[model samples]
Target chain A: METSTRVPNPFAKRVIVVDWGTTSLRCMLVEPDGEIARETESSRGIRFIADRAFEPELMNALSSWFDEFGNLPVIALGMITSRNGWIEVPYVRCPATASDLADGIIQRRLPNGADLYFLPGITDTTRQPFPDVMRGEETQILGFGLDKEATIVLPGTHSKWAKVGQNRILGFQTFVTGEIFALMSEHSFIAKAAAKSEGIDWESYDRGVRVAENATAGDAAFLTQLFSVRTGMLANELKSEEMQDYVSGLLIGLEFRQARDCGWMKAGDSVGIVGNDGLNDRYRRAAAIFDLVTVDGGEHAAIAGALEIFASVKARSDAA
Target chain B: METSTRVPNPFAKRVIVVDWGTTSLRCMLVEPDGEIARETESSRGIRFIADRAFEPELMNALSSWFDEFGNLPVIALGMITSRNGWIEVPYVRCPATASDLADGIIQRRLPNGADLYFLPGITDTTRQPFPDVMRGEETQILGFGLDKEATIVLPGTHSKWAKVGQNRILGFQTFVTGEIFALMSEHSFIAKAAAKSEGIDWESYDRGVRVAENATAGDAAFLTQLFSVRTGMLANELKSEEMQDYVSGLLIGLEFRQARDCGWMKAGDSVGIVGNDGLNDRYRRAAAIFDLVTVDGGEHAAIAGALEIFASVKARSDAA
Candidate 1:
């Protein structure tokens, strides 16, 4: 709640961006323009950092850059800002802009006198079943740029589909497609039948997407379609090696289908694909099936979004 | 495929009913009237039985039964009859009868001179995305009685929604709801938040069922709704122990909803709940939210169906 006075010309200096999660810590020393100056990472996730020890653990990763850069302002995102993180910051309810995210930031001074600003995740309270929440994807949505209205797809463990326009994330939903894919591949019955393959089998993957595309919502076919990955093998249509990609394809395809059903987009719409989840191409291919034009969110969308939020905080603080 | 002469009055004597799954073998000694005289189970699943040793494993489990009753006809179902099981009996495509399943039986003689009938699984080639298949559920539908046209739900790791009437399984679809529940409770993000409970938490369970029932298919709300389990915890709306049951309720409700979308049942229709999966009461509660009246399928639906098919095979073989 207590924010220190803003230092002048903050945009010219380096900023430390931390993506803290359950099992790992990643720190990015970035120029104002979003290019990485230096990076450090370790397994000292917030979960492993004992109570009241997060600052020290975080400093362990950020100290060298701090010593060299002379007290760079730190921006923490991801689960690091969650209730289980160093300090639990409440989520900024959408429709949120960079400035609104900035307003929701919790601030503290580091041991080295550097200001630490924890960016709050955003929630889409309008979502049915429950008010949907996302910790880090909002930044990716921002990083991808919000000037143009588009249904942005940030594919990850829990993929987010957001409607961004008018400089705010209007509302969003999470699909959990990737997590389901991982669960099926690692622990479900499909795990046994599917073999580890060398790379993504686009053919197998596209076939899965097509399967999702072919299914009508009336069929309530996602779960049933999932079973086909196994049956397809039994029917000699899908090879064991192909099962992995086929399943990935099927689930991702289902996400797109579900998103459409939720009224996220329709034919002839342009969708921006963002994030660094290594699944961009697959999503692009999936988009084509749904007749959506694609726009890349570019590299460093998260970093760009982070810096944008930081700049907004400084801009407002400087004015105040 | 080779079925020999049916010795007269096979069912009047004792029948050995075997439920052979991936990891266990269960056998029941049934009198002519479908009463289970004695039951025995062992972990000697076909997978653990080593090469050509299923017969030994079966003998180990049933040697005493054979000693007292002489050679009883062994009827096997489940994954034990799949490609990985002792014999891969092909699936009988639907709109199939008990007679069709009886006709599709692959017969072999045990070393004990008993006839072992591998019951063929049934597949609905009619399903979209891929042909839907079930190994043992069709028999449950038969056991539940095919005299009346009704929707029969067999809840298990992979639950099946089936239609039966006129002494035939009209068609059916499988929903991996139970499997997804297991996966979420044990391995997904929900696992850490959910604690093992002694019994079903009806309130939490019903809340989940209601959540699913409220969401229209167009909402594509299932995946988004699952995130609420975690968010609901964050919001302090759900307790740790309640997570398991709530998720169970949600998935099962979704299953019912999806089944309805697939034209399995309507708001006013009565559905038959079968199987011994220990979740019938919970399912009955879910069925009610959609205004569905439920009929109970008696204990040992699988066994009763098995007997019915065995009788059909015997009657046809005797006539031949």
Candidate 2:
């Protein structure tokens, strides 16, 4: 859905949405209305690109596209806009709109006669301890659509629990759930026993979710509940093959419980689950345990979001 | 302190208590009354003991002590009694006494003509999701003295919050607080940005504890709070050097909060902090944040516990 009744595709031109992050880069030829055509990806992420030679590396990666399509305007998102990336773009503070992000969009002309635009991330100043922030996720949340009021969960290494309403992103909080799960799965005592698991064991996974729900509802054993992944095995309740999914379920479940505690949702509230991190299914199941209705924000929200914001930027420039 | 009014040193012999865990081995030549005459530690924990060659490894690690003492009795605690170790001794259920541990001891004749005793770990069956278990800690708790009823917090890689009363360990729960902290410190994004810091920044650490205390006192954001180490840095509230201690305080603080949530502690209550993991100072600081009194369990709690349990075993067999 188009966020607000903004002028549609004000530039009426095709865009090459570049989702460049720390570890990988993906470029997509997206239509004005968010239809993605031929795409290419590489391991040449910002981290791998040395000496800040991002321009040449990007040019080389898109050399074929530039040759065929004649310098299509490029829109870069994700960590490419971070302090460590090609250019450090300032974050637009929430509650933010597509136009707000468009206003913050950094524009530069490419040597190949293409216009380059970098979208700024967003931050929540009201978050205690410090302002909570996200780079690519704000755009991803924007892609998730802001036509209706609801809680949107974009699950990833650093999962964001965001509030979207009134055509703006109200605020959001970050949960290091995935990173914790990955760390435990690879480097912890849980990792030692969970070795050689083939795939997700739904039964064990659901059991984990149940444990988290029970703990959340009754006792506050979030830390103790984490130890359950091991305790369950010692009790002959969880098998080695099931440990991974069990830990996965438990971590995601805790994320949901924590999110609820932070006032993002209640049992009866509907929440939109969006992200390309492949954790949506698990998150959907987790939402079920919390009595939350899941609204599917289709894949390609990043592409949709980038396109929409780019069109707004073009409209503003033309008006100027 | 002696756990109860038990007969002292029934065998009238000095002892060697071996705290062999997953990654290291600590052997102490302890006098009958728990005085450490000499000690040695090695990287040769259970994981490094190849081909089940634990006997040879121990002999080599303690060759000098054996040469000097001829044949002191050896008592094994920690992971050495688990399934992966030399012998799979079962865990004694909670509400266990020193005598129960003594009765569960598995004795073997070493090559040096010394009696080797293995103390069984303890498990709380009432812990939801599954039984919570702790190796070596039960003995340490015993060493902490069970005569007075009190809640003991043993901080470690897998910290144990145990209840002691009537000369028996009533029940306990395990929190992987230390493990999570280590994992985040060395592997997570927090580790990435937190480079080159020496010593604990007490002020930063206190701020982290405050964050956890506030989260516990008001809302639930354990996962979100973990991200504060990063957010605090991004906001310039927490300097890079302070990140480590801040995370340390936050993790231990969450452990306390979770323990209280699990009904193990409360404000105005005096809790004893016991363990060999060198985390008591931080735990004490965290306890203060929750309005709880901290009682130092001293450094040699493990040695005392092991000696006391060993003494009980000797008394039992002699009586039999």
Candidate 3:
């Protein structure tokens, strides 16, 4: 009876933050102090949730957490809020803050007596030819903080370079760097010659970064520079095992170069690198080479962003 | 016996030229006037010729030509001369002419007692980090003729930008534009969203070209500009149907931009578009947008190059 009884604390303020993406589902139960109390995850992402079975899938994934923590409010982000997900939430256009993001949050109720909030992604309408958009990264950027007028980079499958100032995300751009790197490394002519290895070759990587940083005319051409990977191997400059890291450095370096060209950051400026996609180190390394001082961004920025937006939305609802 | 009779003429001077590649084999019975007398092609490329069966496969592919032409010398090029091919021929270093290419030829006698010359690929040793090598493109560059001092672009999976002057290929750079386009359009996030269509949308393509042609400091960065393809769709500026051609234009245009950055061609300069990959039209269009005049490079440049290199080698052999 004692074990079965709900042991409640005066500081108990529990909530569920669900970061559901196209390929995976992850739910984190946050305690009063924003520490993750319990976590559950699965491959049953929005795409994998069969025939609009989002409710059943969600209930199943969070059943253990719910059984432990009671009916906690859930704040959802990522592809789960996209057109393909449970409900299509419209993007909140930038220059936006946590409150603005909260205002854009879409709400629904689950059968288990819990409120579900789907966070809206962000869009930069000023981008040329079309508006640039970010799904989960905008939340991470928000979590990274908006008080500082600095450039923030959230590197992932589609890397983002954003300008944050005045407690708002001013504008942003996406670079398909990770996607390109994955494609080239996994299924390309470049992939064929690479010797698989788990360790990073910093020397080869540094050489690749320098190639990208070359001020000589024609040396900065990215497409042409890619050929140097193969040529480097053939010329015995880069060994087979060094190919992947070298390519990684080259790509990340180019991202910095392009970001610089786009006025994201200058030579001496500091950049905030958000997100934990295992690419932050490479970005940091590249930033250092490009004369940038990289600032530490919180790893839990996504959760913080979700919590802030949800609280603001709940406040507005209570006020109304 | 009458059907087996060889039709001989006084002007029947001919040679067998084989463009043996990774996935296919193409043999041409070339007349003395540089015309193709008869041709045969098959899937029996170097890769398919198992267990060092290169001779048997070569004989089978050109048996009819061999029987009719009676011991004509064969000139082979492309991947057939690569390390994985039948015989690994070393690359001829730039700035090379037909004679230099001829000197690099690796000769072997076929079992049928006919001469076989494997034309070496060209390597630009002066290229940064490593030497840049091209197998068949060098021959095509040769075939495009060394009579004029002009920049020539050979478009394919690995497109080339070469400068020719004083009857030689001065130096060159390789842009993996075609390969990148193929990978992105076939196996990327861009591929999933694209609505497949039989016809190309030229207007969308031109818009993409203009995006790459952006004089704005940020517009010219290829990695950032690539994101526009996705953004263009999200903002309804570009439809899913137009994604392919638009991406194509953006990539090809970037190649030209990068080539220009490398000093391949200046504004208002005439450059030759060589090779017939069905992509020449797009390249020509891109060239026009960049203010470069497109000249017709010989369609039979590969064959012409092989023949000239063989002739030069044979002449040098005689003199020696």
| Each candidate's DockQ | 0.59, 0.66, 0.64
Where is model 3 chain A poorest over a 10-residue stretch in terms of lDDT?
A1-10
- Which of the predicted structures, 2 or 3, would earn the higher DockQ when compared with the native? 2
CAPRI level of candidate 3? medium
lDDT per residue for candidate 3 within B74-192, as digits (tens), equals 88889989888888898888889889987888889998999888889989988876778898988888777776787899998899999888889888889999889989888887556
Residue A51 error for model 2, in Å? 1.4
Give the best candidate by lDDT: 2
lDDT per residue (tens digit) for residues A1-320 in model 3: 00111222122488888999988898888877777777777788777777878888888888888898788888889998887789889999999988999888888999988989899999988777677788898888877778879899998888999999999999998888888898889888855688878767887777778778764665678888888888887777787888988898888888888888888888999888888767877888888899988886766778777776766666677799
RMSD of each: 4.8, 2.7, 5.9
Candidate 2, B174-261: lDDT as tens digits = 8888888889988887557876576678998888888888863224478888888878777778877788888888888888877877
Best-fitting candidate, scored by DockQ: 2
Error of 2 at A118 (Å): 0.8
TM-score for chain A in each prediction: 0.93, 0.94, 0.93
Off by over 4 Å in 3: A1-12, A314-320, B1-12, B314-320
The digit string of per-residue lDDT tens for model 1 on B1-320 reads: 11111222347888888898877788988877667889988787666777857778887888899999899888889888888888889999998888999889999999979988899999988777667788877777777787778888898887888888887888888888877887898899755779899967899999888888888654545667778788788878888989888888888878887788788888999888887768888888898888998888877878878888877877888899
Predicted candidate 1 versus true structure: per-residue lDDT over A37-64, tens digit per residue: 7887788877788765788887778878
Model 3, residue B221: what's the lDDT? 68
Looking at candidate 2 chain A, the ten consecutive residues that score lowest on lDDT are A1-10
